[model samples]
Target: MKDMFCFQCEQTAKGTGCEVKGVCGKTAPTAGLQDKLVGATIGLARAVQKTKATEATDVCIKKALFTTVTNVNFDNESLTKMIACVEKKKAELDPSAENYDMAKLWEDNEDIRSLKTLILLGIKGVAAYAHHAEVLGFRDPVVDAFFYKALVAIGSADAGMNDLLPLVLETGTVNLACMGLLDKANTETYGTPVPTEVPLTIEKGPFIIITGHDLRDLHLLLEQTKGKGINIYTHGEMLPAHAYPGLKKYPQLKGNFGTAWQNQQKEFADVPAPILYTTNCIMPVKDSYADRVFTTDVVQYPSMVHIGDEKDFTPVIEKALALGGYKEDKEMTGINGGKKLLTGFGHGTVLGVADKVIEAVKAGDIKHFFLVAGCDGAKPGRNYYTEFVEKTPKDTIVLTLACGKFRFNDLDLGTIGGLPRLMDMGQCNDAYSAIQVAVALADAFKCGVNELPLSMVLSWYEQKAVCILLTLLSLGIKNILLGPSLPAFISPNVLNVLVENYNIGPISTPEADMAKLLS
Candidate 1:
């Protein structure tokens, strides 16, 4: 029998499933445990369907699913504990409930499996956002309710394309609400983001590097590390934390330390200070810096120190002080050799400048808006994003978010009408910002969003991207260009549906795709 089977990410082995192990560095055993974790959560959903879901069940379900997300948790011990938690919660909800065997879905017919996988993976992404929102005391009943509904549909023995297709779109529609919930949680908690420039230089002293997407964790760390002589630098998805008024208030919340998530192994190998991971996109730990890596929230790795729910960052702070950071200020640059990265152009910031942007467009100073956004991976051809942004006409605006912006975020793309040519719109969770900007721009132009001279060229690596794509498609957005590869879990039939319905197409060369998008 195959050791494991996973195709949830864009870089699945050979453009098919990974049977021997996961391309994301998960062992066969870890993969099996993750599948079991998901199975137990499904089982819990089944119980919740029969009985009512309490806040405990809701929290357990979200944590279980979030733990299984790519690069989040690799420890079998933690996975086993999570499974027990799910099972225990299931038992509390309904004593007779049983766990669904994930193997059955894996071996099912391809098309049905594809549709269910879409719902399943899409919810996994939703769970992540919900977890983040819930952390900030923000919860949406609609988003919580959809999780149970989708999970039940996945476990249904007689589920078919007819039964699952609409749910798949509903997954997207619900995800839009979930994203909105997260957006509200973030903005209300931290205040609306404003445009800010983040430096890449690392100041000398005891410091901590925080990666991942959790703003609350960053806020807490920034609070605890205050006046402690420990400077904190954001990494990967945490780079956008600099844009928040709440986070940027801390003087010691120093500059960003690295680029996208995929480069962690090389970028972090010898870094002096401790690195705190608050969410996914963590790679397999290297012996070189493993001792310095600490994780909190759903992010965990074998033998890595995890800051538990109490959220005390004492260990991370101690480690940073112990490491004694750089002896002198260290200079860093992004992929394009630029010294600083600019971010914080969320919906609030973008919309605040709507009149100026509208005038620029009407005056022909801004020709088009290209959203070169989504997750970035280690895969080749990602440079296409950098090249595409480089090739865009001077009058066009390039909006980017998530780690994919690392491909060109450092490039000095001159401004149009006093606004930078390229605007960094926070993290992947901030796709809501892009959508809001699009809809508002469409409203300003008195046109449909699809007719607003905007194009989305997305680079996806994981499930979050999947749900966001579903959200975009659910809104009837069309002609999206996605690459470096389409998802392997999407069967030809489902892909055909997307192609016909949404005009979604795989990306080609930057030159050709840019010409086509412009044309």
Candidate 2:
């Protein structure tokens, strides 16, 4: 049999669909198994769409789709379990229900594949947020309802381009709500994040490196290891945890340990600390620290101990103690050689200073607002984001989120009206905070967001960025620049459709893009 096709991320083979293997190190067998899992999940959704969805239905569907997201789960054994669970759900909901074969969509007309891929990839991103929110005891009915709707639309053979196109944008509408729910969950559980400076040095003794974006897992780990002499350090998207009021109270919660998700292969190799992954951006495990990887929720890799619902960290804690991290204090720094970084300047923080921001704008002290944010990647061109920020004028405020900020996050961009020129707005999920701040600013200025001197220059690396891009488009935001590169799955016709509708284009040089935006 021939290999399966996949192009859901920015790293797809040759900047297009992957045939033999995924660009992110996923093998042909792994890709096929993931496709099978997605097919089974769609079958379960088809079954649940007929019957009223129960809580179990919603949870299972979200987890199933989230698992298929890029770089999330690579273990065929765990995927096999998800497939069986979905089949069982289909049987329970309606024994006669049948799974929609995903190959049909992949092999369909080019235009259909483009539009459906948008909806499919968009929902995969949405499922990640919904799963995060669900674990925090927060759930939105509309957000939950849209998952089934999107899955049904993608699986629908009869749906025309006209149908899938709107559904593609609607995925953004639903994802906005999902992000909102997750923001609420994080705030309510962890308290609002305050502006905080996190150190880059690792103290001597036992420590655990926590990566990905799930705060609940971080919270659980913090609680389980309270007095165990194990230090917890944030890595990747979890870096913002140091700014949350509830989490930062833990004395043993130390500083960050890595630059970005893309550099984990080098950053994590030969590390003394055990790493616990709560969500995505998990690269293939390296032999250097393979024995120390502990995963909970949907993040899975073969042979690594899966932290089940028990959520116990005793095993990870024991590993950290045994390894006895850093014979001496290891001083690390950001890419820019800064010893500290700032985060948690979320919407609540931004809005609290809205009057100062508004006054600065009125006084012409702040000329433009640039949201230079998105997923960071290994691509060479991504240096554009770093240079773009370095080149952004002093009178502008740069807001960033996700792993993309690692490029220039350590550079001291100076302050404007008592606010840092570059503000860290939590994780990718906290794009909700950035949106909130934008809407609030627009309201304060009594102008539409586009008219408020704001521009978004985003870097794309994964499906989460795709959903966030759709959200911005659905809101009628225009002239946005997206790079390191566009998604490989989008056909030229679909690209024309997006460009014609939204005026979004690929990134140019930092100087050229800035000249255009600040002109």
Candidate 3:
């Protein structure tokens, strides 16, 4: 038997192929099955676009896409079942079209291979946002149709860069819509986020540490833990929950725990509380904390307690009680000396005061807007983000999110125009919030998002960040500064295409990049 078979997306095999099996935990059979699922989904997307779209079709597309995300699914049985579901949906939507063979795309020419990779990867990213929106009961036609269009492009060899390039961007544009849908769903469900300070310390007694990007799960946990004498701490992307009015109102919803996803092994090793992972970025668990880790939603780990359909968190609660936390009230601080950090500056809060922001800009009080956000990693170069935010000119406002905020989330940048210079807009998924704020600002200034005197300097460590970047590109937002390291997966040709069309580049030193962006 072959040792491996990879080539799922751009991050697969250096734009050529993957070595030592799948880097994302996929084996030869599993990888082959995923490609089959992707081909079937493309066929389904193509079939559905020809007619009216329905909720069922959208849900099917989303689930299939999510199943293929790195580290999400590894079961061949589940993947094969998903592929069958795609076939059923394709048949239900368009009973007459010939089934498109996915093998054609994989076997196409290398140049065509590069272009289709962009579209496929872009849509994979789009599927993530769509999945999030679907969870919140939101869906859009344009976004749904493009999933088919992108897949159809992958199936057709006639298409080239000229065709796939625009399609890749369309993924970003649709992501904007998908994000808007999610933003609406979240803010509407939980109430608008506002400026609130959350502590980093765990308290005495029982508590739950919730990570991942899903607020619905976090909300449910907060509801279940109510009056149970258990405290809840936000970990990873959930750190921004402190800003939500509904969540913050819970007295036991307590503070934050741990740092970024990469550090979870060391951070949670000795913790006295159970940790819940609602989505991706779950590292391989250590035996020390293995018993205390739990997974809900799409996050799965072997032997860990998984809170399923009942959504009942009693097991997690009991684990917290057994751990019983510290014997006394504990104190904690962020990377800086600050004991508290501020968040909840989502689009609603920012846009509600759009006129004031415009006035501030016109009055020359807020000189620039800097979006220094993305996923944080274990690498050393990441400290540059903390330094970058720290050195931002006093007149500039820095908006941040995802796990990267852990680097400097504790740093107090003071305030500008009665607003903190450093604003945390929730998790990586909340890139939707940052985009909304930018779009609102652009609307107020009567200019495009690019012309709004704002800069996006980001760090990415996983697929979620990849999708967000595609969404940014889809929106035609340019001059993004990306760093820590380039994806070991993106081929040179694909990188060239992004650089030429979108002005995307690796981040240099904060000083040099800042001067260039400001200039």
Best by lDDT: 1
The segments of candidate 2 whose C-alpha lies over 4 angstroms from its true place after superposition are none
Question: Considering lDDT, where higher is better, how would the candidates rank from best to worst?
Answer: 1, 2, 3
Error of 2 at 101 (Å): 1.4
lDDT of 2: 0.90
User: Would you list the rank order by TM-score, best first?
Assistant: 1, 2, 3
- Tell me which of candidates 1 and 3 scores higher on lDDT: 1
lDDT scores in order: 0.93, 0.90, 0.78
What number of clashing residue pairs does each candidate have, in the order they appear? 0, 0, 4
lDDT of 1 at 161: 83
Over 242-350, each residue of candidate 3 has an lDDT whose tens digit, in order, gives 8888788889988888677777888888889899888765766788898898887666655667677678999999999998998887787776667887888877787
Once all C-alphas are superposed, what RMSD does model 1 give against the true structure?
A: 0.8
* Residue-level error in angstroms, candidate 2, position 310: 0.8
Residues 155-216, model 2: lDDT tens digits: 88899988988998899999999999999999999999999999999999999999999999
List TM-scores for all candidates, in order: 0.99, 0.99, 0.88
**Comparing 2 and 3 on TM-score, the stronger one:** 2
